[model samples]
Target: MPPQRATLLQVAQRAGVSRSTASFVLTGRHKDMRISEDARQRVLRAAQELDYRPNLMARSLRTKVTKTVALVSDTIASEAYAGRVIQGSLAAAVAHGHLLFIGETEGDPVVEEKLISDFLDRQVDGFLYASMFTRNIRLPKLLHGQKVVLLNCLTRGAHPAVVPDELTAGLDAARTLLDAGHRAGIYLVGHTRDQVFASRERLAGIKEGLGDAGVRLAGTIDCNWWPDSAYDAVCRALDDGLTPQALICLNDRVALGAYQALREAGLRIPDDVSVISFDDSDLAAWLRPQLTSIALPHYELGWRAIETLLGQPGEPAVQRLPMPVRRRASIGRPPAE
Candidate 1:
């Protein structure tokens, strides 16, 4: 037979006090209830001896606050690159004495709706809608009038959000190259469009950074975010004798293609040609001469989302976290003529 659980009645009897007095002491309401300190200590000791555990569900029913939040995301739960977002959210939720329930929708509206409905039914205190990438999102109707925070994504409405400052990241990347003394032969390896927020902001930042240095971009290649397209673009540039002193790639994948093209042209990294880029993925460090890049701050984004939903101080309606540079072997002083 299984061992029976200890009850508050048993604890109160063992402590030589009424059940109400024992309850007041256990719940830290002894002072409000005017219970003596010695009585409170006796109740605590009795609870310890009896190994008593409170019924959280009953407590929550009386308090009317479940102390739980739901994290709803599209692809973030499965994607390795965005896993830190979940880790950060979990840490922040636990720190606040709350529990976090995670759900992935895989970009399906039906799935998202069902998940939101289920969470609402469970009496979750708040919702965190996250995304694997930075883009505009359509929040579900179920989240209306409820505490909700967007993570790594934004909406047209006044919902609070936490995302990376792509513009600043671009500017920083350009400054990193310029700081290495590359002036006239700096080339951008990707182009930006209207729909993609990061690309547009990052490109603007790069232009601003270069303008600050009193210099201009020598050239740009439209690679459409594909490594093969970047490789082809770099090959064509080399064939046309466009030997740039430095290359600012769109992402680590684009940089990989540039690396291959550079090797084919017999150019050594940071010696004959320097390289820098963004999205400091594992591939950045995996390259032969490690690629210097900017991190997306995925974990901080998630942490800030929870903080915003929890009504924590210093959380803005729209929070843009800084993207720090990861220094590596791919960047150095440009070769002298």
Candidate 2:
């Protein structure tokens, strides 16, 4: 048989004190209980000597706080690119003296409900409802009336959420091109369906930013937000005599496609045509000219969502974190007409 574990009774006996006195000392309630310093020292020494370990389950029975939180998401944990989000949440949870349990639902409602029920059964202190991409989400009914914070997503109205400032990033993209003397012949390369949150907000900001300069986009090259689609659309546009002075792609992938099309047409990046995009992914830097893009702040979003949920009490409101710009060599002065 394994060695017997030391208990509070054993510790009390070794410390030459009553069970209540040893309990008060171990729980740090000695001063409140008017426990003697000498007794406290003796109890601590006895606990050390016996290698006593408090049972967390037993302590939680008295405290009601299990000192743990759960992070439930739809495919965030599996995405290699989203690893930083989990890292950020883990760091914040640990700093607050709590353990973190992660679960991925893969957008399945039944699985999501089961996962959430399991967390609730364990009595996790709080919840982080996250999404891989920013959008409006329908929170599971099980989460109602519980402590929760939305990560990279939001609900219908006012709620606690941590999302990137995509609108401001769009505005900055416009300003970046305009500041480089791009007066006209600017084209936006991406699908601009208003049903999508990021697309609409980004387009609105881009319009507002360019309108402030009293300029407007020459046109939009409608295409799916991907490399091959972007490449085909841009190539066809160029073949049809579309001489765009600059292209503001929706994301880094679209930017890569635009780069390929521009190069194939013998139009050097930032020489004959300038370029800018968003997401600031690793692909942005690996490009030939290195695309100038706005960052998504993935890690910060995860960290701040946990903080909002577990930190000091605050009014429930949406928190839109800033998306900083990562300037590179993709943009420059407009070419001579």
Candidate 3:
């Protein structure tokens, strides 16, 4: 016959303590109940010997707090960047003694609502609406009365959010180019009205930096946030006889395409044209002339989102994690013609 499972009574008997004392120690309330240290240790040892595992459902039912937080994301596991966010968020949540429930919405609000409704039914402690990009999407109203945290998302009306400081990213990119001694024909590649909010901000910062140096916007082309678009943009610039000394791409994808365009046009990078971008994606390192880029703090954004939700609530805090420039081989002085 199988060995009989140990019960709380058996543990109390083994510890030679009152049932109430055993309960307090096992439930981690011994300090508040002023249970003796020796007695507490005995109870703990008894529990360990018994390999006692408390039923989480029973505990949560009694406490009325599940202690689980839901992280709702649009295509979370689909993107490389989203994976980093999840890692950071999970680490933070675990450190705070909270379990995380991950839900992927595939960019569908209806799906997100269903997941949130189910979470609410389960009495989840909080909600985190995470998006891959900083798009101004409306959150589910079912989140009312629940603590909501926005990660890599924009909350328009008095909602706390954590995002990359693209303004600094742009400035840093400009500073790199300026430091490289390339002033004439500085161009911004990729980015249009439909671009992500972070993209727009980075572009604005780049423009601001250039303006400070008395440099005018040379030209811009929509790269559709893709490598192909970037290549096309470079080709068009070449056809127009526009040889920019510096090309600031919107992100790694555009930078990759820009490199192709320049190579096809027989222009040596940094020697004939310098290239830089935002996001500092893995592709940046693989490029022939390693891409110089602004490294956005994606992981920190995830961690901060959880921290803000648990900490004391205050006026909607908008945190911009600083994005520093990652210098590499893609930038250099313009060739002396």
Residue 313 lDDT, candidate 2, scale 0-100: 74
TM-score of model 1 (CA atoms): 0.94
| Residue-level lDDT tens digits of model 3 in 1-24 | 988778888899999998889989
The order by descending lDDT is: 2, 1, 3
Model 3 TM-score, 2 decimals: 0.93
TM-scores, all candidates, are 0.94, 0.94, 0.93
Tens digit of lDDT per residue, candidate 2, span 100-152? 99999999999999999999999999999999988999888899989999999
Candidate 2 residue spans exceeding 4 A from truth: 1-4
Error of 1 at 125 (Å): 1.0
* lDDT score at residue 322, model 3, on the 0-100 scale: 87
Q: Which residue segments of model 1 deviate by more than 4 Å?
A: 1-4, 311-314
Name the best candidate (by lDDT): 2
